[model samples]
Target: MTIDTSDGTPAASPDRPATPKTTPKKTLRPRNRKAQIITVAREQFGRSGYHNVSMEGIASAVGITAGALYRHFPNKQELLAQAMLDGSSSILAILDEVDRTDSKVVFTALVRYGLDNNFRSLLFDQEARNLTPERRTEARAGVREVTSRVAAALRHERPDLSVPDSVVLGWALTSIAFSPARHRTTLPRKRFEALLARLFDVVRTAPALPEEPAAQPQPTSNFSHTSRRESLMGAAITLFDQRGYRSVTMDDIGSAAGVPSSSIYTHFGSKAEVLQAILARGNETLRLGLVQALRNADSREDAIARVVHSYTNSVISPDSAIAILIEETANLPEEAQASTHIAQREYIDEWVHLLGNETADARATVLATISMINDLTRVRLESRQCAIEDLAVRILATQTV
Candidate 1:
């Protein structure tokens, strides 16, 4: 009888090429294959975006056949949803053990957990967007539960903060803690943990948030829809931001811009070109911000502060261009993706060079600071409060620490 290996490959037999007599290699299929599948799926999904990864790729990584993977997950969507939900559940389990009342105790536990399982928070942000509306909501509900627990702990520690402020701080803490996952941080594990602890302290002692001011009116475009090409670009960005780039169609863009779908070709060759245009505009905006920040700064310290504020303003504003620049670039064609990535890297390098710390750890810390600020401010629409921007500058300006 032919024996099958745990990896779903059949053992070599006489019908195959003759071979020297040897024992068949043992494949230990772990009893907890489901857990292992989820773990591998999370890493793959986080490293490569949801659309880029395939079930076969994930199964191969997990040392199982595609058939075996299917037994655990019905489709890629289920894997995406379950991986995040399971990750959140793991965090919830950790929260259950800690003293959730003491903010310090809770913060320490969360930081340690985040360091160990860094990818969980990232999947919650980018990959969850690929899920169906109901699945996405279910996955996010788990994250909200984790956030609320931390916010409650903050309230217990500091009573002066309003409910909204505490919740904001809660999210800030979580974002800061898990930010290392977004970059390659080469810091000694202990030192990195200490850095996170200090950042939590920074937020912990921050002044109580003030009442939210009235919503400011957006600036009117000087040439609003006067040009067909510009109008199509604007419509494409909004659609891509609200839905993902893959889900938005050329027809959708044309309809939103008040043009015939075929007429979209007159201005833009394809959807990819439209996306490339939107990202190009965003890159130019950042370049200009950097220039202005440098030109107006009184000193090196002032330059860093100015840059941080400039970036925070770009991220916190209602404009969808920044969001598209950040999230949708992955869908661009290979050459376009490379160009966008190079621009983004150079932008970060400017800040690192400004800090005069070229070490890997410094770059990693700066990256985490920028990513934490962007993520914390964008998680909730209400999180656009000016106080969050202040906190963001505070976080990045402390890179010397």
Candidate 2:
């Protein structure tokens, strides 16, 4: 016989009551959690700019408390730096995987990779400047490396083109590939890729423009004490374009406008307000110009040419504020961002109408064509007016495959 247990007959408890079996609570390991945090942070930082995204926001996105987020990243800056590094690393890996000897092959690979990893492209373009100087330099080096490789490949394939032309073309093609990142467009992946490849071929075969002195932007007579508010807006746009929205301070804007820092509050409540005003003015400018172009045109083709000329001229004009408006709108406050986007949508819709594109895919193709025109401004080409109009006509006439 067995001896009885001394503790309340627990040895025979199975006969009295059965203990229920429980599953173990699943938990993410530290490495997996860290990876999750980076991925979520990248998406958040890409969607909303670095200044707009908070540590708490990222932590919430990762389904973790802020304290836990600190355990992984010492601060938001570190998180941003790491996110940029991760993106650059991934992009460089893709570049390495491609056959870099063939310009067309490299471009197709990069376009596909950029489209597939659109968020990463957005992060690099929009938020990379938020990093510290040292970190920014590091991120920039990776970009330059990609550009250099592409330029090298172009040199190999297009022996007829000069070194500088090949380099600029490389940059332009990259810009075209990354255009989808800036706009919200839905298309079948295969179709979009094919369209992008066709676009690349068009740009590749297009004759290179001779590098000429860019026309000096005429001095604006609008920036006087009587136009202090306009002066400040102009100053802010320049600063924002040069240093980015997040990097600029109110005092900086004030100083640039030759006004005391305290005086800025008289015109705008906050920095975001200043940005909103700038964007509103830019939207109004473009809208008015487009309306005028439409009124003056004898035909749809003429309207398109006039619109393209108006846009490119505005971009090069000293007082034109569209660059900052296009690039920094994401840094605006939520309400302002919404309104600005609505304005942008109206602009694009007008283009779609002009293009006679009724379907969603056609609308996307129209936007891409517009993007190609915009990208041309990045290179130093002579006769910008004629170049822009010719390109616009060609792009509009070309059917998306």
Candidate 3:
């Protein structure tokens, strides 16, 4: 809605009105051409990915000649790079705000930003391939900013850890979170969150950092077991979520977990075990969240609210494990698959239980309703977030009622 003169210039922001010292009195008032080009490029890049969009295409969209565009940007790469940076400005803003917070906050912020901001994800996943070499490194530097933020948070949260300890663990957290945006578009939101919760539980832990003596036996009875399991699942989720089932090997999981290539067997019998654990924990986490949300529900409306809010919060929140579980369930062993199924069934049964015995006879109808609820919620998470409340209401009316 705001633009500077047709001459290329940055727009005025009340936040940074033209300052006497900052602006020169005679500079032709640096036009909004750069901003205008960025806006048009965003539309073009988003509609057709980087590969499909051309310099001429963007120039045409901006109502300028390709030669005129070169006046602002030396080449298409510079334009693409600038547009990518512009596209991710919101993410940078979020990262800026969270940079001062704890590791828990950083993990939460990264996941929240990735899921809620589709444009951010688009630019994030596309920039490496789309931007020029000079700018690609810059884009990666922004990505590493998240890693640094995570590391700093980890350092403060776990004071006993050394510098290396923080760096390595921060990498783990970033890997777990960074995968979904790069892939997992068709995945359910609740599922995504359960994985995050599971992953957060992972990044929030350390197996007694390398700074500690190898002979020292770390404390076991506290949150160690629970945290390690989630950590393993987090690593597994990243791998399975990124590389499909047939392609991911036990070695891949081990490498992802930062364990010795042969050490994965020390915990689980096979890669199947890894899959099972990730999917099982994912479903269990989701089931418990849904169960807890509906424990006091007395009306269909309340039931719907509790379910939608609970699942949506998890989906929207940084700790999304549910999406990871459902998306990767097929990768698990046969026995693990059963646990995953039971966990999912229990989530729906909890919803059904909230509806009471009256709907018991409507098992088929309830099943259909459950599917609708899941589908609508997932759709809300994936594409149209603005209308999530309306979507949830319609879902409740159709199914819970």
Candidate 4:
């Protein structure tokens, strides 16, 4: 028999078919979802390393399904490549408008762009290694083009500087302008922009890189034998610096160290453990050097100079730990990431303290100086220690506008 159901629909009987209720399907993706996805992807990739971020997380952040995101970007690599290329295009576009001869116009526009796109610097340096070789080349060409244009502009301003020096200075400016991405800063927008503008002048007037010093022989250590664990850590960082951490394998590390893959487990639990150990050692070295730099100072100015020089030396050294520290920290286990970050902050705080101003601008300046040194050193672009140190000191000594 037919009977009425709770909602007044007729219940199905042996001879009656049930009525199917129809509801309108809700649309989940936004009309501008493609651009939205790229924006959020850049933010997440910059905040966390590329391998550490997931397509699902990106989709969720964009308020869409994974399938929808895939429609826009097939994989995370494409998203990274797109994000970097987009940034490159944006910067290049800005340069296209400004008069290359007008230093103020060039600096003003660039600082504004840097503040707006702070994350691009981090993604450009630390995460681009994860891209496919073809995409990496494409992204690299974009970066080189930006560097070339900026160098050309700088050369117009300073007629005496060589192409190499102008490129190096261009990198310094880019690094300083984007330095806030390396660490968080609390300065308000206007103040930050002014600070960067002042730094632009600092870069403009800084002396040309002095001739590179001759390589001096290292003093012989009493202990000739290197520990297996130490050797393993050294090999791993070199590999990590060359290839992104995810691309490297435990077997690759072991082979580089001239040991079997099984031997690595005896020294370290996993590839992650090896990375953690390397970062930990790097942090310790930085702290000890900081303490010594402070302890040996004859005066306040002397202390600042000593610290700057020592840091420049360490950062530019062969297979420097600074690169891996910046790039691979996101790959460490969560607890390790927290501790390492705290230590890094403490290190920066010490520098800020030494600078004798606890203001946000001072902290930002110190961060910028450190980032500029690290960026230049990591790329192996220009290792002129005295020149870098001079520029660093000038950056630190700039008054807020």
Candidate 5:
């Protein structure tokens, strides 16, 4: 029987041909199968995170039964851990590509390529600990080295900055590139640049950090339209973000969501299901935020402000998805990680599309927009604050200019 890979792609059975053509003399090559599973597994993990997916689910996606998958991996954890290994290798290739070059252009191009394709993200910001202990240790070791190299590159560019590489500052910069932010989400590329330029002027010219923390928002009151599933998800986000995903059990999620734990079986089979729900919901909210910003924007300038308002609201204000996404960074398995990445890509692509699909600068605009989000997230993670309206306006003005 043929098993589907985790990404919904079919993998042809190697033992036999569909047409009944006997090629018994053929030597089986493992590379082809390994590559196929890697692709599917990455898609699953990126979209779902770690705890939310199953090996059986991944096997089904690959067009193979879970029993069939056992031929390749000892168990689900092995599959996930190996997927992380393969994904990290792909990233190392990208880093190696530019290791010889000092040009920021190459760095920018690499970042641009990553945002456009969502491939590099598999490397720099993964949640791959769902693997078995033996494999997980190996995977984490590799991840640390890869991150160290990336951090070194960033530090190379910003030699003037006081923060050291591989620490909170480094993690913060990497976080910006991967996380979605408001000001970056709403405005056109030209206007967004203006916003960045203005911010830099202030950063370079100012004598001290801003005195106040970013503004606090009111708690959500729009549950009127939310479903039981969504309520569970929303409640789960609050709890998961507060207590951490692994520490919180399925029972806690069920109790907090006010749904019978069994309802989770109906809506989502496990606590992991609830986790994926939070990740997916975060992506959806960001998408909706962009749409709302566009609708509310009276001018190019205003558009950026609306986006900033949405992004800031989501990340800084105790929203469900933001912390959930970050928390999942170290614990996702192959199937869950890839799926989450694809979902986030779809959102970023929408931003790219917003820059005008046929525009010559569309890709650059999207990457630049992505870069802005990275910067905005940097502020939030480092200082733990952001000015929603101000950040959005600055990004919009820069891009417009």
Candidate 6:
């Protein structure tokens, strides 16, 4: 008589005394698979944004089944929360190890840490908003701690700067470091690090702007849009900016615009189409403004100033749609996202071309400078335009240095 083995092969005949069959061993996952999952999830979330990536997609990217992914993370929120927690913890640990007395030392360490873990920095900036309230609080607390530490370091180094200025400078340096996480570049790592260090020095030594009056709320016009399509577009941009694109629905938008939910389709095919239109319009406006600014300039410096002024004005206005363009672009449909990105690249390339730095390092520097100005917009400077323009000039000076 023959006995079947677990592998479905018949065992050796008993007459041969059948050397004992060896049972096949099941493959074991790496002990740190959970950590691995979080790492992969960070890259996915950072690249695709939180709303665009799915649990199954993450699992596939990690070479695991959806069931296995669940075995590690109960749901997407838990995974995102864990990723943010891990990233924040890592950044804090790096900050702790660096000497905080010297602003340069702290800033250099931050730039290195940020570049080495660019994906993690992107997670903190872009995906942290998707976490649950509790997790979001935890992440924000950690970031605030790091920011406070940097601010203290800035104060220690520059006793002349006011408390507010020091805090703003600290945030500025942090934004400079995180800038690389937002774009792609081919500059060598060491070269990029050196450029960032120089940029930090420029920011550190720059003269402070005079304080201005508090920001006054700009008056709004009472006139209403006669076109339903225009009204819907306006309402959608506002809602998309306030609540992320994923959270806003057609019905919600219709109510906000006073259009029937069923009629929204008559104007636009879907919510994604609405976003596409918004992005296209914003891109065109920026492109046209920049071209006009460049055309009217007499010299390289004049052109740079004009471009920076125009770009800053467009982004800083209360009614500016640039925020939606920046934050929600990743949530767009693939084809629309590609088109927007192409347009943005052309825009950046124009800046780099105009900067007269067509090399990879120069391109990277230009992008970083733009990023610094863009990020400073969020700081609520008293003299917003003057501060931005001064900082832009200072940032541009670093490329020559």
lDDT of the candidates, in the order given: 0.79, 0.74, 0.58, 0.80, 0.56, 0.79
Question: Where does the lowest 10-residue lDDT sum fall in candidate 5?
Answer: 202-211
* Candidate 5, position 214, lDDT: 50
TM-score of each: 0.85, 0.80, 0.39, 0.86, 0.51, 0.86
Candidate 3 residues lying further than 4 Å off, grouped into runs, are 1-228, 296-299, 316-319, 356-386
Model 4 C-alpha RMSD vs. true structure (Å) is 5.7
Error of 1 at 250 (Å): 2.3
Per-residue alpha-carbon lDDT of model 3 for 109-190, expressed as tens digits?
7677666653333312432454557787776676556567778877787788777656655655554454454331344666
Off by over 4 Å in 6: 1-29, 120-124, 213-220, 295-298, 379-385
lDDT of 1: 0.79
User: What is the per-residue lDDT of model 1 for residues 346-399, given as tens digits with 9 covering 90 to 100?
Assistant: 998998888877767667767767776777766764444567766765665556
lDDT of 5: 0.56
Model 4, 31-69: lDDT tens digits are 777878888888887888787799999999988889988
Candidate 2 runs further than 4 Å off: 1-35, 120-124, 210-225, 242-252, 261-265, 292-302, 330-335, 369-393
Query: Going through the candidates in order, what is the number of backbone clashes in each?
Result: 0, 0, 24, 0, 59, 0
Give the Cα error of residue 195 in candidate 6, in Å: 1.2
Over 4 Å off, model 1: 1-29, 120-124, 210-223, 299-302, 356-361, 381-384
Best by lDDT: 4
On a 0 to 100 scale, what is the lDDT of residue 332 in model 5?
Answer: 55
Cα RMSD of predicted structure 3: 18.5
Which lDDT tens digits does candidate 2 get at residues 14-90?
A: 56674455789998557689778888888777777778789998998888899999999999989988887776677
